[model samples]
Target chain A: MMRRYLVGLILIGLAFALFPLLRQAGVAEAPGPLASAYLENSADDFGAANVVTAIVVSYRGFDTLGEVAVLFAATAGVGTLLTRRRLGKAVPPPGRQGGTEVLETASRLLAGLLIMFGAYIFIHGHLTPGGGFQGGVVVAVALLLGLLAKPDAQVSHRVMTTLESLSGAVYVGLGLLGIVLAGGFLDPRALPLGVVGQLFSAGSIPLIYSMIGLKVGAELSGIIDALKGDRS
Target chain B: MMLEIAIIVAGVLMVGIAIATILTRSLLVSVIMSGGVSLLASLVFLLMGAPDVAMTEAVIGSGLTTVVFLYALSRAKQPDDEDAAALASPPGDDTDGGQP
Candidate 1:
C-alpha cells in the first residue's frame, strides 16, 4: 500500500510538471512550414470547412488509416479475451435484467434520435466539428440501450462483419484511387474540390467519413454483441 | 485556465479511483468504481481540448467496458458464505456424535 501511494504521488507530481509543457504547445505560434502550409492549402485544396478534418483525412490520411486498424485490433482483443474457450468456462447462468420501465421507454424514444444525429455528424464531418468517430460512437450507444433493456437481444454477426469489411475496403480503395489520380495518396484535390465550404465539397472526405462511421458502428456493435453473448 | 484546472483535478480523481478500485474487496464495487475512473479520464480529455479522444473514451471505456465488467462480475462466485457460518460454530460442539 505504501508503494502504491508513493507511485500515485509521483504520477500527480509529473502531471503538474507537464501541465505547462502541454499548455505551451497549444498556445505557441510558430511560423513554420508545417503550420503555414497547413493553414494555406487546407480548405483551398481539400474544400473542407474544418481544417483539422482536412489534415486528418487528407494531409495525414495514412496515419488515420492506421488508427482505424488500431481500433479494429482493440475490438478484436476484448472479444478474444472474454469469449475464448481457453480463458475459462462460461458463466453458470445468465444474469437477471430489469431496470426502470420509464428509463427503458425513454431510451427507446432516444435511440432513433441518436441514430439520426450520428448520421448527420458523419455526413457533415467535413463541414462541422464532429466526424465519423464521434458519429459512429453515437450509433453504438443506441445499440447499447437495446442490450440493457432486452437481455436477449442479439446483434447479427453476419451483418456486422459484412459492414465492417466492406467499409474498410471502400476506405482503402478510395485512398488508392487518390494515389492513381493525383500521383499520391489521399489528395482530396484529385477528386475535383467542389465549391469551398459547401456541403458537397471536400471531394472524398465526406465519403471517407461515411465509411468510417459505418465501420466503427459495426465494430462497436460487434463488441457489445460479443460481451452480451457471454452472459451465460 | 479553468479548463486546465478541471483537467488536473480530473486526472487526480482518476488516479484516486484507480487506486480505490484496486484496493476494494468487493468485486462489484471495484468494477463500478473503475467505470468512474474511465468517465473521469474521458472528461479530462475533453477539458484538454481533444474532443475526439474524449468521445472514444466516453463511449468505449465508460459505456461498453463497464457493462462488460458487470457481466463478468456476475459470473464470478462469491467466497463461500458457508465457511463463515462454519467458523461461527465451535468444532467440539457436535453433541449428536457424543454418544457414539
Candidate 2:
C-alpha cells in the first residue's frame, strides 16, 4: 500500500511539474483568434453578462444542444435500469413508500423558490452572469429536492418529455432560421438588435439561451424523477 | 507563478486523497476521497484557463457523481464473513450453514 501510494504521488507530482513547462511552451507570440475574440467580442456582440454563456449559446450552440440530448438519454437509461423489471421477482422493500407532511411542506417551499430563481436567471441571462444551463440546472435541483422530500409526489413524465422535446425543437428551429435568413447558424444579428444593454438586446442569443434553460431544466428533472420514482 | 503554486498544492492534495482512498477499507471514505480527486482536477482546470471545463468538472464530476455513487452504495448489501461455507457449497445448493 505504501509503495502504491508513493508511486501515485510521484506520478501526480511529475504531472504537476510538467504543466508549467507545457504552458510556457504553448505561449505563442501572436494571440489565437479564440482567445482574442473571447476577450474582445464576447460581451459586446452577444449581449450576455457572462462570456461563458455567450460561448455556449453562439460559439458552440450545436454542442450545447448535443449536451442536452446526452442528458436526456442518460435520464432515460437510468430510468430503464432502476425499474421493477431489473430488480426481479422479490418482496418489495419496506418503508420506501408514503409521504410526510413536513417533507412535503419543505419541498413545496424550496421548489417554488428554486423555480422562481431559475426563471429569473433564464430571463436575465443576457444581462447577468447566469444563463440557460446554470438556470436549468437550478431548476433540476429543485425537482430533485421534490423527489427526495416528497415520496408521493410524481413528476408528470409526459409533461417533462413534451417540454424538453419542444424546447429543443424550438432552439433548432431558431438556429435554422438564422442559417436561412442570415449567413450563419446562430447569428445574433439575424434578429433585430433591440437595444445594446437592454433585456431584449442580442437577437438570437437570449432566445437560444432561454430554450436551453428550459430544455436543461426539464431533462434534469426527468432524470431525477426517473431515478427516484420507482419505489414511490 | 501564483497559479503554478495553486496547481502544485491541488495536485499534492489530490494524490494524498487518492492514496488514502485506496488504502482505506471503508467504502464511504473511498467515495469522499474520490470526490477530493475530482475537486482537485476542477481546480487544476480553472488554473489552466479553461473555466468552462472547470465548471463542468466541479458540477457534474464532484457534485452529481458523488451523490450517485453514495446512493448506489446505500442500496447495496454489506458483505460479512460467511466466506468458506458459502464458497464450498455446491453450485446448485441453496443453503448456507449460517443462522439468519
Candidate 3:
C-alpha cells in the first residue's frame, strides 16, 4: 500500500513537472494543409457533407476496413473466453431481482425508438456528425436496455453471426467493385456522386457506412449477449 | 467569455472527479466518479466545437462504460450493504492511510 502511494505521488509530481510543455501545443488555430485538403475536397469528391465521414469511408477506407476486422477479433476473443459452456455452471447472480414493472415498460417503449434513431444516424452518415461506429453502439445500447429489462432475453447467435458475416462480405465486395470500376480500393466514386448535401449523395460512402453499422452493431450485440451468458 | 469560463469550470470538475475516482474506497463510487469525469469531459468536448467526439464520449465513455463497469463489479465481487456503507463512511481524509 505504501509502495502504491509512493508510485502515485511520483506520477502526480511527474505530471505537474511536464505540464509546462502543454502550453506549446495549445494555440494552434488553423487547420494544416492535409486537413484543409480533406475539408475542401471531401464534399466534391465523394459528396459526403461530413469531411470525417468521407475520410473514414472513402479517403482512408482501408484503415476503417482493418478497424472493423480488429473489432471482429475482439468480439470473437470475448466470446471464446466466456463460452456458454463455461457459464453453464452459473455463478449465480447476486440476488438480482427482476426489473420493476415501470422499468420493463419503459425499456419496451424506448427500444424501438432507439433502434430507429441508430439506423437514422448511420443512414445520414455522410451529412451528419455521427456515422457507423456511433450509430452501431447506439443500437447495441438498445439491445443492452432490453437485456437489462428482461434478463432471460435470448439473442440468437446464429442470426447475429449471419448478419455480421453478410454485412462484412458485402462491405468487402463493395471495396472490390471500387477496385475494378473506380480509381482504387474503397473509392466512393464507383457510383455517381449524387447531389452533395442530399440524402442520396456520397456515392458508395453511405452504403459502406450502413454495412459497417450493421456489422458493428451485430458484433457488439453478440459480445453483449455472450457476456450476459444467456441462450445456453 | 462564457464558453471559456464554462470550459474552465468543467475542466476543474473533471480533475477533481478524477482524483476522487482514484482515491475512493468503494469500487461503485470509483466507477460513478469516473463516469462523472467522462460526462464533464464530454461537455468540454462539445464546448470545444467537436460535436462528433462529444457525442461518442457522452454515449460510450459515460453511459456504456458505467454500465459495463457496474456489470463487471456485480459479477466480480459484490460486497454486501454493510461493507458498502463502511467504505462510503470515510470521505476526504484517509484515516488508515488509504488501506484497510
Best by TM-score: 3
Of the two candidates 2 and 3, the one with more favorable TM-score, higher being better, is: 3
Per-residue C-alpha lDDT of model 1 across residues A1-232, encoded as one tens digit per residue: 9998999999999999999999888755565888689888787778888877887788888899999999999989878865535334333333556657787788788889989999998899888777888889888878888777765555777888898999999999988888888757767666778987788888899999889998999888877776554343
Question: Measured against the native two-chain assembly using Cα atoms, what DockQ does each of the candidate structures obtain, in the order listed?
Answer: 0.15, 0.13, 0.16
**lDDT score, candidate 1:** 0.77
Among all windows of ten consecutive residues in candidate 1 chain A, which has the lowest summed lDDT?
A84-93
Every candidate's fraction of true contacts kept comes to: 0.20, 0.02, 0.18
CAPRI category for model 3: incorrect
Q: For each candidate, C-alpha RMSD in Å?
A: 8.5, 6.3, 7.1
Off by over 4 Å in 3: A1-13, A91-106, B80-100
Task: For residues A1-232, write the lDDT of model 3, one tens digit per residue.
Answer: 9998999999999998889889666867899999999999887788889888888898899999999999999999987876644434334345867788899999988988898999999999899899988898899899999998988767777888899999999999999989998999999888889899999998899999999999999988887776655343
lDDT, candidate 3, residue A117? 94
Clashing pairs in 2: none
Output the better candidate (1/3) by DockQ: 3
lDDT of 3 at A2: 100
Q: Name the DockQ score for candidate 1.
A: 0.15
